[model samples]
Target: MVSQENGNQSQQTGGRFAVTLPLATLRGVGVQLGGRDILTDVTAQLRRREVTALIGLNGAGKTTLLRALLGEIPYSGEIRFDCVHGNRQQPGHIGYVPQRLRIEGNLPLTVFDLCGLSLRRWPWFLPLGTRFRERVYAMLDAVSVAHLLDTEIRVLSGGELQRVLLALALEPTPELLLLDEPAAGIDFHMQEEFYGLIGRLNRERGVTVLLVSHDLTMVSKSVGHVWCLKDGQIECEGSPHDLLHGDALARIFGSHQGVFGHRH
Candidate 1:
């Protein structure tokens, strides 16, 4: 039990903590599409310098919830960011890498072009000065794709394309990074390498990461916290060890038990 004055002090302390830290808060978040609730009454708090994984079966609304956070989908909720300093509206503040990188038509856009797209505020189309070129090269180098700067996008493999997309997302040095199945459809080695890079990015950049993935093994090892979604609701959320113990996983994902099996 807590006293009234103590509760007030605690609340004040919590507010101060929020203001000081680089965190994002979502309260009573709900998303409905086509008269169907895809996400209902979901509440989550993402802290800075930590990785949060969104894990669940297909159609569990993980991607939908992420989209809502990006303001791409209409949602009933409050998303407050503790934007330190004056760099709040910058594009690099929230970087997103979508699931697929399929671009149709045979446009001869090079890797440099893909990276240059991130420089929307620049007046010239291509990277003109040494500073801009260095920045692009640095981003490509960070993803280990600098050698392919001149390679055409249409000619790159799936894994190569994913790297380029990641480079684009990291161009602005974003505070919050959202990755949707960054390892999907790639080979096992590439997946491992990508995870290593993501881990380093989180650790070194102090970037808050939110990952939506179906790979339970990787999710269990990589993230500090996991939010398991089912039927448009958060079924359970905790550390992997706590949530994946014995029948708890079975309860969240019953007979169809695969990586993130659906209960039925």
Candidate 2:
């Protein structure tokens, strides 16, 4: 593991984009839950306009780190956001797509209703205005799900639901995007397409992405940087080619290989 003091000094490459700025920096960040140290002396940087994959075992605190960065949980040390000029509080906007949304299968919630709940400030009883509906449609259209606008959320497939959630997250154009296993239940082909969409967004709009994933093969293809977390701290970080090949993967993952399969 890289020591906290030396973590920030590690080199970062942006792959196709040539990005070098640090979008977010974590220094000596620690998280404790139920009197147990969930994370100790964690330090890392999420490069601006780049896709970073956070990979590890199931209980390695990958989601915990994301929650800490989102300010959703209490943590020690500092998480600084350099999204805007002279602003140190937080990013101007942060788009988040969680692992899953637990909605009752019987609930009569349409895609428009789901989007409106977040996008529209008005109460659900109020009729959605024409302009608001248009904005929502356009957002869905960008993700190629506009046809599902009136479709019930419960009836949508795993991939469709993910796309809808992604659309909701993209609005207002966030400087940072946090995805916790965004493609968890989707089929492999759809997962590839989804990652492609994410990569396209990073390249086109310059959105910095911090992705938590277990699919090492997909991680290798999708992200520019990979951070392997183990026992609640970063064990290794580098490009996929540097960290995911040969003995490096075995060193980081070890007995947890069954969780995420790979040819190498």
Candidate 3:
């Protein structure tokens, strides 16, 4: 991976690493879909309790990397986890909030029904006990959306749905949280609120986050470390200031000046 060694870049001051230990490491990770390589020899580390952002142009394998970590797709390489509990071949507890949830055509499921179904494995008709409701309430309350518990999922706006999804992902307090374009389709204000919540989670709960987003401006301000994926590989990795404000993004993105925002 390329390193940003530029001297003029501002150093990240927010304890860029509370713990330098790596929570997870990916070495020579590669993924192929439909006989086409989606990721190639991607090597990177997710530091313990640090928020890392993955940024790249469309089809840059950002989401593929996240999916590979989730083990939803087969890949060629070693994904090793060395959490505080113990070393493991797979992740312990992973919370994933996808870019969007696609409900079946015109399905009329309330926020309660959606969260309740995921919280338990039984049929949808099965009675959700008071304890279950209380648990869900606490989860929603964390994201400040408990009042929308009974609202129809279909009726929710983009921001509301994303918040609801975030609440669901925080359950059981996962060790690693994977968010894909979490702020996409939401207003700027909502995006700011969402990112603030994520930062709080990292600081308070020590939940290691690996997020994939196209919003370079937000990623620059919200994350500690930023990974630039170009042509299916990690082109560079460093603090947001080092990567975003330095020449790293220019080299990784090439002529995509408007996207990087570092060039006038």
Candidate 3 lDDT, 79-109, residue by residue in tens? 8766544445344478899875789858989
lDDT score for residue 239 of model 3:
84
Global Cα lDDT for candidate 1 = 0.74
The candidate, 1 or 2, that scores higher on TM-score is 2
Candidate 1 at residue 192, lDDT? 88
The alpha-carbon deviation from the true structure for residue 159 of candidate 2, after best TM-score superposition, in angstroms, is 1.0
Q: Worst ten-residue run, lDDT, model 1?
A: 1-10
Give residue 65's lDDT in candidate 1 (0 to 100).
Answer: 83
- TM per model? 0.84, 0.88, 0.88
Cα lDDT listed for each candidate? 0.74, 0.82, 0.82
lDDT for residue 228 in candidate 2, whole number 0-100: 85
By summed lDDT, the worst window of 10 consecutive residues in model 3 runs over 4-13
The alpha-carbon RMSD values of the candidates against the true structure, listed in the order shown, are 4.9, 4.4, 5.8
Residue-wise lDDT of candidate 1 within 1-264, one digit each (tens)? 010111111122433333225366666788999999888877666656788788878777888887887778898867666544222233547888897666875989888776666574676544467777788889889999989988999999878888888888886777788898887877888888998899999998877799988777787878877777776766667787777555777777875356553332
Off by over 4 Å in 3: 4-18, 84-92, 121-125, 260-264
Ranking by lDDT: 2, 3, 1
